[model samples]
Target: MKVKGVRLYGKDDIRLEEFELPEIKDDEILVKVMSDSICMSTWKMVKQGANHKRVPADVADHPVIIGHEFAGDIVKVGKKWQDQFKPGQKFAQQPAIPGQAESPGYSYTQCGGAATYCIFPNDIIEAGCLWTYEGDSYFESSVAEPMCCVICGYKTNYHTKDRYEHVMGTKKGGSIAILGGCGPMGLGAVSYALATDNKPAKVVVTDVDDAKLARANEVISVEEAKEKGVELIYINTADMKDPAEELKALSVDGKGFDDVFVYVPIKSVAELGNQILGYDGCMNLFAGPTDPNFSAEINLYDCHYNSTRILGSTGGSIDDMKEAINRAAKKEIKPSVMITHVGGINSIVDTTMNLPDIPGGKKLTYLQFDMPMTAIADLRNLADEDPFFNELADICDRHNGLWSAEAEQALFAHYGVK
Candidate 1:
């Protein structure tokens, strides 16, 4: 089978092309991708090139397919899988299928999200990371996989530095302060925080953009919270020289929030998260800055004196994806708002190559895998119909076409994305 996808040849070089997919073995299940979200990690690879230690060295050498966050439907299952799995069911899948590696932990690399179809092993199928659901839309299922990554945060015990554990709990009372709340991952974190039993008492969101802050508030419902709900607040960071100081002042009666989640990559945000810690506060470092050389000054004294605890989380655990599936089904949260751009699979080359200029939020580049050749060029129209597309266009126009590769570099040089 031929699958259309976006591949990265090197830094600042991406190509959308087709590749031959291996025939499915009796133990493999092939999934037709419905929707795939552009992840920051993918964006990092696009800008920095694949020279990192975590990724498989050969993956970067080959025409590597780009994408890690996605949702899809089971189009065909092997004869062995048919007995346990059904066709036409919606599922949120983690794409990494481990090959010859010394250990599973280091060996298993998730699937590339930006493809028409993906194949998963039979053993992983039964583990339930690839969730099967009834009466769900493909677009919504796409959100589940990303949400699962957010779920891993709730299940994480950062203080112990122990393996992640997803234990269910009540959704009442605890407050969640989401730093860098305007970005897509922060927004997704907000969704997971809202849908869970440990729903924060007050959901405070902080961002540099008033527009994004306003956008976050607009998506939250006041009426829906008639029975039991969390209070939502969006704060802009542009005004504050010290976000930590501002956070301290905003705390209830000058007491800081219960949980402060740092989604921004800057070192200052991580340092400030510690300063504003309330008694037994949980500070979660959600975003992983691409530059490993980046480091920040921290006041360890605050951590010891204040009894503040900090934890770091990344990507989705299988259990987190399962929870994301249930939450997506409930419509309690929708990440669609985070999608600021939509282009076809072919456009992905230009789309990813221009990540820095995109300015905070998700960009969904469309791919016409199933459509005929005629559909490839015309597919932008379908994307234009989405509200987020309008937002992308407006942003692009506002920034003087900075969303393009050449333009973004100039824009980033001004803002120092390099």
Candidate 2:
């Protein structure tokens, strides 16, 4: 079968082309990609291209599809796993295949969700990274991979005084701060921290843009945070005289925050997150920087006397993905909260290239190839120009500008595709 997808050849060299997919072997599976959420990591891979470690050296010769956060349906299964998986079943994946440096979407030449179809290699299948999904929408399932990474970051920052055993996760009933919390990944961390059983007394989310902060509040409302017994505060520190000092004052005793999550990989942001940690506070660098020698200053005196520690994580384990899936199923964590834009496969290239400039939570792409990347909020304005968008705007308005499974169904119906 021939499929259309955007492939990366080298740095700044991504092309959309149609190619023939080879037949699946006895140990492989063919999936029809339903939804793929563009991730910042994917954007970084696009920018780095051959220079990226996970990118295959021969990518310039044989281009590779670039995406990872995706959900789909099993169109065909290999003979070896015919009994385990069947056609028409919904599926998602962890994407961080255990031993492989480059998982599907980053390294695999024939596998990625930017296309109508992709193949699951035997290694991925055997590692059990692929999951059978049961969610409200493919968008939710696709974004579970990123949610898993968020969960992993929290889990990684676990520490203990005794050193014999350690508590894994943020301190309960403690003050927490999320730097650059308006972005999609930061928003996930904010929602997770607020909603989870590991309750924080207060969560102060900081960003430069007031619009993004307002969107964050809209997506994860104050009422929702109050219901969870969390005091959620959104702050724009762009013009603050001393943002770190102001953030520290939000804590109960004004000592500092218990857990600080740095969502942007910039040195200044990371240092600011470190500066606001209280005694025994743990700071998790949640974002991956493109620079190999990304360095930041640390207060060693605080680390020694206050027991402050810093950590960083790239992706999550398969188990973490399962946990995210379970939480999404139970409504403990809403993956849909991260989706702000929707479109089809044709939107992948432009969306991926200009992801940083695109002001939205997550850009979700369907394999249908007809729809352009359209923000749910923008549909209202589009309604004035086109009757098709008018119906979409109505659907989005009903959901308060948030993308839902119903809206997606309406879109597919509008496009006359499934």
Candidate 3:
């Protein structure tokens, strides 16, 4: 079978090309991809290429498809898994296989989300990483992986009343602060924080940009959170003289934040998260940095005498993805708020390669068509040029300028799905 996909050759080498795929074995399954959200980690891997841990050393000779967070429909089911899975079922998958070198996206040539059709290996199916989605839209399932990462912070965080034992998960009804919480993952944290059953009494989100903070508040309004029995606040620490103190003042009794989640992989942000730690506070360094030697000066005094502690978490387990799917399906959470741009598979190369330069939340790519990368905010600007953008803009406006299942359905209709 001939399929189109973006492939990586070496350091900073990637291309969109049509390649021949051999017939799937009896144990393999075939899927037609619908949606994929580009990640900063994907760009990092593009820069490192063969040098990347998950990528093969001989990628120059044998290229691998590039994309991980993806969702699509099953096209063919092999005899080995006919009883377990069948064709035409909506599905999404977790890319990370514990202690395994070759998982989809980074290491597979025929089983990555960037392609129109990819094979699902027997191993991936058996690992329970592949999940049949029952959500309203494919984009939401594609976004589940990143949302899982954001939700993991809350689930992985721990607080302790005693020095002897640790209390797992975020402190219930306690004050929580998301430091640098205006980016994609940051906004996701805000949503999950408010939506979860174990809601925090006070949720404070801090960012450096006025526009970003405004957008965060607009997507997740303070009024909406109040209805959920939580006080949601947004702060722009761009010019604040004492940002840490100002942030701490927002907490109950001016004590400090019980849980501080650092979303930016920056030294100052990590330090600020440390400074705002309340008594018995837990700081979760959630962002992954490109630099291996990334370090921040923490408050040792608080760590020892004040019973404060710090930890880091990355990549949500399968359970986290399941929680994200259920929440999105139930309308309890809107992970789509993290998406700011959309495109087709043809745009995957430049979009993924230049992700850092791109200013947006999630850059979602639908694999079924060919379209230039367009931002949701820029849709109105292009309304006069193309009626497609005009219609898309109208659809988004109906949903508060956010992506929805309706918007996705419109895209499928507009692009004439493969």
* lDDT comparing candidate 1 with the true structure: 0.60
Model number with the top lDDT:
3
Per-model RMSD to reference: 8.9, 1.7, 1.2
TM-score of each: 0.77, 0.95, 0.98
Candidate 2 lDDT tens digits, 153-268 = 87787757575367888888999899998888888988788766788899999999988988888888878898989999999989789988988998867999888999988899
**Model 3 — which ten-residue stretch has the worst lDDT?**
159-168
Task: Please state the error at residue 126 of candidate 2 in Å.
Answer: 0.5
lDDT of 3 by residue, 126-222 (tens): 8888869787799999898999988887988887655768778888899999988889998899999888767899999998899998898889999
Residue 401 in model 1: lDDT: 30
Each prediction's whole-model lDDT (CA): 0.60, 0.85, 0.89
Candidate 3 off by > 4 Å: none
Candidate 1 TM-score, C-alpha based: 0.77
How should the candidates be ordered by lDDT, best one leading? 3, 2, 1
| C-alpha lDDT of residue 34 in model 3 | 93
What 10-residue stretch in candidate 2 is worst by lDDT? Answer: 157-166
Model 1 Cα lDDT, one tens digit per residue, 67-153:
756656677888877876778776666543333221111112224567777677666675555667763445455555556667777
Order of the predicted models by TM-score, top scorer first = 3, 2, 1
For model 1, give the RMSD to the true fold: 8.9
Go through the candidates in order and give the clash count of each.
18, 0, 0
